[model samples]
Target: MKFALQAKDILRNYANILYLLIGITTGCVIGFLFGNQVESIKFIGDIFLNLLFTAIIPLVFFTIASSIANLQSSERLGKLFAIVAAVFLTTVIISAAVMMLVMLAFPIAQDDTLRNMAAQAALDNPVSSNSNTSATGLAQVLTVNDFSELMARKNMLALILFSLLVGFATLRAGEKGKAFATFLNSANEVMKQLLAIIMKIAPLGLGAYFAYQVGVFGPQLIGVYAHPLALYYITCAAYFFIFFSLYAYFSAGKQGVTVFWKNNLTPSMTAIGTCSSIATIPANLLGAEKMMVPAYIRNIVIPLGAPIHKDGSSMSSIIKLAVLFAMFGKDFSAPEMLFAIFGITVLVSIVAGGIPNGGYIGEVFAITAFGFPMEQALPVAMVIGTLVDPIATLLNANGDLIASMMVTRIAEGKHWLNSRLPS
Candidate 1:
């Protein structure tokens, strides 16, 4: 009976991953067979994307506000924040280091053919034609204006700030604060339920989206830009499996690694299928529960990390920077440029979260950091982002779960996998 139960549990854990794989495979096969005709199915993908976007603002606001309001004490909140921030920063530093070493080992040469094609494509594409618009400075990116703007999807940083303030205020409002916190918590629960319902159609939604993507981009573009895309995917996979697994082992021993992979498999698959970390939050929280992370820690870290801790974006940004540098015949090895890339990539990753098709933000930063002609660079960057977004999303979503484990380990002085240890 115990063995049968164990097998059932394993199937439950891995079922989503299996479904996603089947959906992706089916989508690709249909896409190749039908080509651009699959464009008709894009509305199905749009519905899924819209469903995710609809849930994001409320989910983020309530989840963050309630988590902060429910913290045991101000001291505990501060400690949790510090631990999560440290882990995120450390990961970004490691990512930057890995990127530098990888680029050095396999330098990409200038491809004038591809460059010209990109330029021509940019000329023909209206969106790319205006890519030379004024650069968005870091100051502008950080600044928040009115409440309306703050609530907008483009201003996730501002929304997070607002949520934190409200949460803190609720914590101090005596009984009234408690009441408000309860409301937020209830609201967050509702959003999670809505997400679960929406996800029932995930295979269909994701399959249609993937089919449309393949049909539109086709195999030709994949062949044309295969090298950098392959490298980016491999690097992300390495980080997700190798570095993350090692980190888990060290943090929680063998049991930690086992729980980490088992719990995270579905979330990682959701990330790839949806190509949005925000959309994967519900699954990530479920994974956190499965891994035995405390509810308070999981609630706070996953929501915050979804937007703030973006290891996947950092790595992809580095890849884009390196490939663009090579294409432009610029030396990326210069000390000043390398430092600038590292700093900017880290900053951009934070702001880039919660925005759909946000990989282009890296290109904007690249334009500012490298003094590159935007018109010449934006097209190639867009192309790179399109191909690498799914893998990058996988990393971003997986990192959130990993951060939850690390935070639990640090704050509770106990490994999440070790139920014998008190949390």
Candidate 2:
């Protein structure tokens, strides 16, 4: 019996290792072959993107609103929002700074095919062209007359603002909004059911999305784009160790971080296997409890933090947007990059504390936040969405543990900086 159990464990470990190899090799192949054939690869990616988000947004809306309602005081709600915004803003600025520094070390060349496509479109719609439009320019034209309006109208900033409004209002209504809130609350439950049905077919979507991406990108782009990919990987590894470990040690205590990491192996593994933070919440909650986090913090913070407190996701967002800007042969001024980071973090952080399985939709929202061309933004999503999910989830899970510690200290009115170690 013991031997059989050992063999099963070994097999499972090997299977996971094999899956990583397959996914990397597959993604490389597709990205290389289809690097220039943007439309076809994008179509497949779009299908998966749509299917992933069809039910995710509404579910997040209600769950977040419901979670806000659970707070004992409006003051606590204000505090929570403040903490979220601060953490998100800090991480975004760091990511954007890192991305800017990295770009200086690895200059990009514009893809001729993408440029040709833009030129042809400009000619076809000459009425759309203005004095600002140029035949040789690689960057997409952004007209001052409508750029900010388009960004707002598309709902990147609006979705976040509206969600916060709904959450705050839901808290304010003495009783009149109770029925309407009740309907949204119930709707949130039903949406989870729909998500469950869709998730069962997630493997199908994953396989097609990846296979189609690999078939298009071909195998050679990895070698062709090795420099940037290498830099991205280095950034990922550096954060995983340096920033996260330091934060964990200081915030959660060294012993707490070690215990949390050791016991929460299952959640990390599940995140990697599924590539969805929402799907891994059960393991995350269990792991936090095992690490001795208070029940209230575990139940409330872990679920809410999964979507919102994505240190790695925010990091990857800055990197992707920076890369897209560079790929079009445009340089973002430091101020522009700073604004992108600040704005993207706010937009992305709105649904952060929502229900599970909403990561993909958040990715879509991030792409829209910056108003990058869909072709460029979508491919980056394919790369980040497929590879970054697990790493981001681990960071997110860690952030929850870390944030809970800070929140608990705040709630207890304890000064964390000068407090003595617990006896």
Candidate 3:
């Protein structure tokens, strides 16, 4: 009887997600039949993306600033960031470890074609190194020269840092800043609702976009790249189903797993369809809320994690290393090599996740670290990154929602979910 109630509740409460699923599935079928001919319809998805992108600037600013400013106790703010950082770093390592094991067990791909390509690539491009004296490049990544630059989506790390500073300032104001805090909180609510409204068209927008993706990239999933693509998608799917369930169970026991999977579908689909972690923030926020995670935690984790907490990238970074190592005939089975790959993947997934051109940054770093030919290694890894993006984004985006559960259990006690449940 309880199971029946839960089933009915999911169907009733999550009906819109079902519609989205149906729409995307239908779109994929349509795309398969028409192939590249659907290019004309891309404008539909473009419009939705533009609206979302424009709205996101205000949404992120308001959510983070308000969450910080409106935090009732300053200590909670400290705990939140502390717990978040720990969770993010821990999960990144876990993800990398899981993928490394899989890669070691089953090498990505070893082919003469890849080797020949690598040789040609080495001849084509010269290797370059960083100038030791310069911290300028690092500074630019975390902040922008002009305040106006923060308004752009490309400068997300800068924007997040700026938002944190604003929130912290308002918080430190105490009672004297009550009015501004209220205003920030109010703005956050309004922006959240606006994002919700924008997402109402997710079915149409995401469906159309998914169609385009299928029509364009579907054919590339064959020949040389086919095996590597299969490995990634399959590994990601297994991790998504298995590890996420384990995390959810750890967070709140059996009930947490139930609540999590019920609410996870929308965020996962949104990530898959959009292939952008930033775009899936709202869905993740809503998903966390539905699971009864505290708003303060979700508000902070979802926005920040969307940019940085990349379980998916952690896995993919390892794959990139594996592919490069294979291409170069390196002893990937060596413990020393895996140790180096482990450290690099962790850095690439967590640190580069927030920076622009993170893919390029990660790929180039992997190439240089292994002394792989940059010319050949870079392009091959780039291709793999593109191929795995959708699934990777699925893991990266949804990981935040589940992380909120972990934080809640730790911060609010193990009985947290029980209180949120009906008596």
Candidate 4:
């Protein structure tokens, strides 16, 4: 009992720092020392990776469908979706712009040596001797491909579409949808419970995964990713402050940003630690309540927003793509970049939302979307995963904040909507 309490306290208190530090340290150390012998450790990492996605299909369908079913009307749902979509679209565009600016400001010569080294390391590191039982290595997991393949692969993004469709159908089904809604409701609740249980083991899972990685790889990653990573982090922070602050101010009005931060910090922290937005939903709702977001919006937007509208993820995707482009000896022309910003980022954000490790998934999607070779994806993903997650968490959390406020403003019958629309 005492041990359990102590463990709980540790998780409740220092879990994020502990998770990050231990992961980096352990992964570097283990990757360096054992290099490939940490089969058990690698297995533990694999389990956590798979664990993230295990409940996703049911959870997404239930959460989205039930939320839609509870809506006052489909018209309201449409209006809300329209607003959310517009906001998300704008966010993605701004994100791409910011990333492009940052990439231009601080262009790092592509380190092919680091990329090759990381890839070779991934291929050579036999973390588990039981190859048959091993899940695909992170390298393989991050491999880039064509956008067509990405769309066709039924990856996470595809699953999200199916979930949304299921949700919309459930809402449109009238009384007959009750049974399905009930089932979905039950499924969502069950998944939440399962996730709660999984979170208890999170510290352990995180510690082992990072330890094994560092243990295998050494501390070189810090240096290798230094400049580009720094640029990514700084740009994301700037976007959070300049853009999201404005969003909060406009949506919520005076004291809006404060309220937004208050409601979102816990979830943001949770996301940073877990690197899983889906996992942060419970905390996000609690936070939204603290912000006094209305039920109509909170129920409708937050859950829906969690999956489909990822402003932060979109930012990371654009930046990573630019990084890859720079790395691959290609200067992003005006047209190519415009296409990347408008065409790729928007579509990829919607598609990559379903992937487990969604933040990294976005980066991988960027690589594939732009027709990059598969080998480049993993190295870039590792760098982005470490560099981008905290910012993404902050942005994602703030997006929830912004969305809550936008919904609140709309619910109160404010003139905010008119400002964005035609007179």
Candidate 5:
């Protein structure tokens, strides 16, 4: 009876995660049997992504605007922002450090076959035009020229800035803005409910996408550059298990670790299946709620974190830089190269965090900044980026949940879990 009771409790709590696992497993089997034919079912996944993406634009706006609008004072919000920045920087550095060790332990070796294939592929299919990314390209990314453009997903950073401005204006309005503030809160709650409804089909959606991916991309996973792939995947796995747990424990001791794992797996799986940190924001927000992080911290942390606070990008950037360095026979550990690699890792994570495939911009930046021949280096970097993307995104997406906890602990004190949320 005791064993059965415990089993029931576990099932009740982890039902969603279990269903996601089953869905993915089923998708994998179907994919393997059908091979590339499974791509036909990709529309099933596309529907889910479209629904989620459409919902996200409004979700982000309302969540940020509402959370900030509700803050009692600008000082409180400022403190949270300061803490969020500190936590993000600290975690990114730690991720880079850990991967630096991993690279030293198992460095990438030059593969003539891989290099030759990369050269041929580059010739046949020119890489994206990011190799010449200019100042105008960056302006288009950061802030759209028109107000209507802000609604688009590609302009997330701009939307966030606008949301923050709206929030500040509402707060500054005092008594006159009470109705607007209330509406913001109500709309945010509605969006939250809408997200919950969308998530019901996640398993099915994720399954179909995984089927398509496995069918199409599985063969490409194992090749001459497999060493770099293994190194990246293994390092991500270890970092998540070890460092994530440590972050949780420090947030609120053993209880933090327990709750985090309970809230974590679902979001992590969603991230992996979707291969997008943006899509994972809804899950991450829910996880933060379960962990009892205040709205101010989570609103700023999770949404902002999705784009900028990517430890995964930090690790992978180092790996990509090293791989290119090895291919070119450059000393990766040279003092100046090490310094440049570290700076570039942080820059890429921040500059490229919000946009889809923004890493291409960073790769271009790296290639040009380091004086690597864009024609030769860009293709290698793009291939490695594509390969490592799934796991790297997993780290980047779920990382926000842990970061929210850290921010709460720092800004609200260690007893933040039990303390009254700041008004």
Candidate 6:
């Protein structure tokens, strides 16, 4: 019985890592061996991403509504929101600073050769050139002309606001509200279970997706754009370890840092492989549980943070901005440029949920916010977003758990980690 239990524990702990390794190995082998023929298996990746996308809307709506409804009092909800918001804002500011410094240290220079290659690539794969005409201003983002528009993935900010309204209304509706909240809670569980089932096949899905991407793009692109891509990967790793570790330590002390990294291993790997923070929420919640955070805190913070608190997106946006500025021969050190980068990245990060490949959507904001040439700048930004998205998602997904821990510590006012540790 003991050996069986130990074996089960090991498998459970290492499942995500095993899957990631298998997927990467399979992708490399298939991509190298079959070349463009690997595109035939692209459907496997599409199905996986589609499955993840299908769950994101309901998961966000139900989880947020249910979490707020369960708060049971306006005061508790207010306090939770305040703490979460403060932590999120602080992290965003830190991420922005880190990104700025990294960009300054390793500036991407424009190369005509690379630009020509990118142009060729864009020509080979003709993407829709339609611009996002939706309201990106603060007022428009917060306002909905039609409530139905909130259902669209692109209107994530409006969707979250609508969910909050529904949650609050459910709280005020007496017994009817209670029943509805209960339904939402049940629905949230169902969505989670659905995610768990989808994750079981992640190896096959991620493998096919990566194989297709590599086969289509080939190693030539990586070689052409190695500097910025490598720099982005290295910077994200530093932020994950240095900034995140320090945040955890301050929140819950040495033991807090220990528990956080120990429990986050699988979730971090899962994020890298799947490249979707929404898909990794379940694993993050499990990590929070392992760190001894209360269920209420995990339920509230993880879901809400997944969409709103995007440290990774902020970092990636900075990278995109840096790349675009260099490619267009604009000075990134200008005060206005710095302010615009900070403001737009923070705003866009909040609404990054709902849209498929939403990371690329930031390019639209860059057009309006910084007046970059849409024709030249947008394509380069899109390519950069695609290449660095997996790492960005990994950062976003891991930061969600870390931020949850910080919020838990603040809300509970007691060291949640202390009691769980050995003497």
**lDDT values of the candidates?**
0.71, 0.54, 0.74, 0.61, 0.75, 0.72
lDDT of 1 at 284: 97
Kindly report the root-mean-square deviation of model 3 from the true structure over all alpha carbons. Answer: 10.4
Q: Write the per-residue lDDT of candidate 2 for residues 270-366, one digit (tens) a residue.
A: 6655555666688877876666555765677668776666766665565565555555445644555666665765555444435444344455566
User: What lDDT is reached at residue 292 by model 1?
Assistant: 84
Q: Which regions of candidate 6 are displaced past 4 Å?
A: 1-76, 111-224, 420-423
For model 1, residues 1-423, the per-residue Cα lDDT tens digits are 997976676566446545655775577678888998998986786587567557657766776688778876635567778888998898877876786678777777666554554455355445634433433665544446566665444555456668888888988886767878889989978876776676666667767766765675665434446777777777777877898997677658888888888777789877776667887899999998988889998999899888778888888788888877875567878777777888878877875773334543445555545655444455456446655776777888888888888888888775445664455
What lDDT is reached at residue 86 by model 5? 90
Estimate, for each residue in 1-423, the C-alpha lDDT of model 4 and write its tens digit: 997975675476445545555665656666667756764676665566456445544554455556556555535556777776676677667777778777777766656544555454346444311221222454333332544432332243443455567777877887998788788878767766775665555445555665555555555655656777778788887887788778777776656777776656677777765556677778878887777676667776778777777777777776666666665556764565677456777766665565443433445445544445433344455446555766676676557657777766755655443344335
Worst 10 contiguous positions by lDDT, candidate 4: 126-135
**Model 6 residue 107 CA deviation in Å:** 1.2
RMSD in order of candidates: 8.7, 7.3, 10.4, 8.7, 10.0, 8.0
- Tens digits of per-residue lDDT, candidate 3, 1-423, equal 997976675466446556666766676676777998887776777676667657757876886788778666734458778988998888888988888888778875657655654564444343321211122465765688889977754455567679889999998989888899999989978886786787677668766765765676463323456676777788889999999999999899999999999988899877776667888898998899999999888888889788779999999888777777777777777876767787778767864564332354456555554556443455456556756776888899889889999988888988899999989
Off by over 4 Å in 2: 1-100, 107-109, 113-156, 159-167, 189-229, 248-304, 327-334, 349-358, 403-423
Error of 5 at 274 (Å): 1.7
Cα TM-score of candidate 2 = 0.63
Each prediction's total of clashing residue pairs, residues at least 3 apart in sequence or on different chains, is: 0, 18, 0, 21, 0, 0
TM-score of each: 0.60, 0.63, 0.61, 0.60, 0.59, 0.60
Candidate 2: global Cα-lDDT? 0.54
Best by lDDT: 5
- Worst lDDT window (10 residues) for model 1? 126-135
Off by over 4 Å in 3: 1-77, 125-223, 355-358
Sort the candidates on TM-score, descending order: 2, 3, 6, 4, 1, 5
The TM-score, computed over Cα atoms with residue i paired to residue i, of candidate 3 is: 0.61
How many pairs of residues in model 3 come into backbone collision?
0
- Among these predictions, the greatest TM-score belongs to 2
Kindly list the per-residue Cα lDDT of model 5 for residues 1-423, writing each as its tens digit: 997976676566446556665776688678878998997898887687667657767876887788779878735556667888899999999999899888877777656643553454345335322322332465665567789977754455567678889999999999999999999999988887787777678678767866865686563424545787788999999999999999999998887898899888789877876677888999999989988888877888999888778899999888888787776566777766677788878977875674334265456556655545454465456556766877888899988999999988887788877564345
Clashing pairs in 3: none
In angstroms, the error of model 2 at 225 is: 6.8
